[model samples]
Target: MPIAEVFLGAFLQVLFDRLASHELLKLAQHKGIDALLKNWEKKLTSIDQVLIDAEDRQLTGDRGVKLWLEDLRNLVYDMEDLLDELVTESAKNKSEAEPSKVPFLLPSCCFNLSSRAFMFDRKMRSKMEEMDNRLKDIITRKDIMRLTEYNGQRSAYRPQNLPFPTTHLTEELFIGRENKKMEILELLTGEEDDGTYMDIKKIPIVGMPGLGKTALAQQVFNDDRVANYFDVKAWACVSDDFDVFSITRSILETTNPQLARECKTLNSLQDELTKNLSGKKFLVVLDDLWDKNYENWIFLLKPFRSGVKGSKIIVTTRDREVASMVDAQLITLEVLTLDYCMELFAFHALGVRNFNHHPNLEVLGRKIVEKCKGLPLAVKALAGLLRTTNNPREWEDILNSKIWDIPEDRINVLPALKLSYLHLPSHLKRCFAYCAIFPKDYEIQRDELICWWIAEGLVEAKEAKNQWNAGLNYFNDLVQLILTWGSLRVITVIYL
Candidate 1:
């Protein structure tokens, strides 16, 4: 399943609670819509388990099952929009109503508002009836559709017993990143022009989550030339939270553990950092940064300013906006070519860099490699999956499996991708999850995506002057996070 369904049940439950709340229930009763809402609540609750079952089966990547699940997901979105409409209308009517006064001596203005509310209520009741009928029709298809219930335990794509190094970077196992490593090294060691005022320069290594931004940064950070060039070196994995004090404390710890243990306040930490870095060139690697606040970034860089010229900070992140905020030179990593991907896959799958010994597996192996889409992490993961299974039939089975069908827990790539998704804000998560509704490689128009986001109520209208601008901002944030392509008119949801 696309994992969006994992959240669908909870979202529906929230809506149910909102509908059943005292204020809304009283309003519904007054408008003669309570009975309809009661019916919806009952039907929705009954089918909640069905949605969960469907979600599990969808993970198997069966086309028919996926279609059915998409239908259910669309209905959920529609129901949510309808609920929002009802809440908005109710609030508007309450605001327009006259204050409680002599009931018998109500003014004509009050009568007009009452008539409008009644008409709106009737319209809403009709809409609810239509939705109820649609839900009934969808439920009746369950038996005919033969939706399979998931019974097997959740399995990830990668094997648990495999000796493949998924987390740790071994220089020998690392392939296809030599050129990128050299480029980053050159940036770190290369001198800046005298015209540039900043003493410490920053270079951001940005790419999609599984594109190996961290690994590449690790390679560069560990390079002998880099180690020899700088007087001091420190590393921090600043994932998500970019607390100024915590980061300063980490830098202090990396440079001098004793000073870090002794310093309790931010001022003391900064003083320690300054004392350690003053007049000495240093290299700092802030890996996996997600913060985009420009002020916060500048505040973090204050102590680094005391370091000597040629001091460098290499920030590895999935967001280009973070790179821009730090005024860093950007080195965006691209997906590997087929040649390098094949080489990496062979090394993991067959314990060699080439498939000469198993010529029979080459053709099938290349087909499997194509499914990886030149992502190094995915290539390594699939290779790890095939390491023990040398049979041609087993290779073919892997080649045929959909990426979504692969269990994320066992698969290094899927889990890495899931982490990126999990870190997204709730609104962005909804918007991005909805993209799963499109077919893989489907070229999405920017405007159409924004419109869908607005319709789904994923983007807050009050946050911007109009829904269009708000949607644009949401889209840009997703782009910055490397979740989607970076183009206005064209974008594609990368197959996870």
Candidate 2:
């Protein structure tokens, strides 16, 4: 029970899982309180505006914020129970009116509310009014608590679609990963279908968060020479949530965007994918995968089987269990060596490989890198913030940051991450901040995150771009802010 954020999972389930259901909507309709439900929906949306900020405030041992969060938690749970009751009651009503219509798991005899409709309505309406007042009271305390609503700048984020990854254009950007990238390239191009790849020749680049697994995968993916060996190529960002239909669609979108748009079903998408990949030496990059279900894995590969024997699928994941799912000849990535980490910091900060000239900043920079504990993302984020300045005091200040004082085990996010987060435009900040609620090393699918932002109203929709596209731009901005294969100068992993 993380009083600040863990309850968000339960809150989201109530908001999304139950509230979005047709059964609840039908119940609201029958009670003629659909308008009231919609108003509550708006209230919950308003509550979301302050939650991440409240979570941040709660970390300070702000007793007031903590109390507010506790109150909010109770309210969310009560609302969830109420919604569940409504749906259950609605289902029971349906089962009673048409006895054969009972839902599979729910027994008609299990009814909590009476078959008498007025009794149910009388009890529910009073509860709904109290919840309504509860939500409003929470909303009023929000301003007193100094919760800033994030209505982001729509104009600041204008990035278009995801940048196409290119290895040749970005190969020189890597630091110590050249060897690993070369080794993987050797496997991908070579017929090393040894025990490592098992039967499918899938290479799993397994590592903990921020080790540059995705960056390494990108290097291998964008390698100029890789294009020559594979006849068909596709890259899919398969984060923790495994939706085979979406993944199949993502692969198709890479191979044939027009055809992908035409596809509506898994069967159709896979058929198109199989036809396009048949007899080809394909290279499929499934980046950041977390799912370990064997049946889903097999089902996902139904189209890939059409590709030739030399076909390759590069899977990057944090879970070794995921590697086991693929019977991976695992290429587990470790943190960069301290020297490499320092060099990475220097390269990003001073635009030099080492602190040969600026000896004044070298000591502080090394100390800062040491604090980062060889996490490339941490080092790069800190270094990138200092890219334009060679000031020693600034370096010292960064080295002495309280973020570094947050013991490594206790802090889920890197201190440098907070520094980097501070530099982000307001628009990207809200979306990126929401990500903090996820546990460390949580694998987030790109679109899934974008959709969450849209659903949560974190994305500001303008007439020019709908919420989804606005979210995409927010996502892209945050992606580039952290790591982009094409542009990030220091070292190349965003979510590392």
Across 1-496, the per-residue lDDT of candidate 2 in tens digits comes to 2223423522443354466667677666655577777888787777776665565565445678878888888888798788878777777667554333222223336334355854665677678879989989988888788886645321122333546544323423478788888889988888732222224588999988778887798788878788988777888877777889988998998789999999999899999998988767789989888898999999999888877777899999989999988986899898899999988888878889989999998889888998887778777777777776777766765675444554566655556765465444445655665676565446579888887877665566634358777777676666665453222221111223
lDDT of each: 0.67, 0.70
The TM-score values for the models, in the order shown, are 0.53, 0.58
Worst window of 10 by summed lDDT in candidate 1: 483-492
Return the number of clashes found in candidate 1: 4
Q: Pairs clashing in candidate 2?
A: 167-222, 196-329, 210-496
User: Model 2 TM-score?
Assistant: 0.58
Number of the top candidate by TM-score?
A: 2
lDDT of 1 at 40: 78
lDDT of 1 by residue, 1-496 (tens): 3544434543454456566667777666655567667887877665654554554455555566577666666776677678778878878866575433322223445434477765665576667767778888767776566644433212222213323222213335667788878888888888743332355788899887667787787678777898889888888767666778877988898789999999999999999998888777889988778898888888888899877778889898888888888786789999888998888889978989999999999999898777667777667656755676677876764565434455646343343243334334455656766777675345578899998777655665544458788788777666544412111111132333
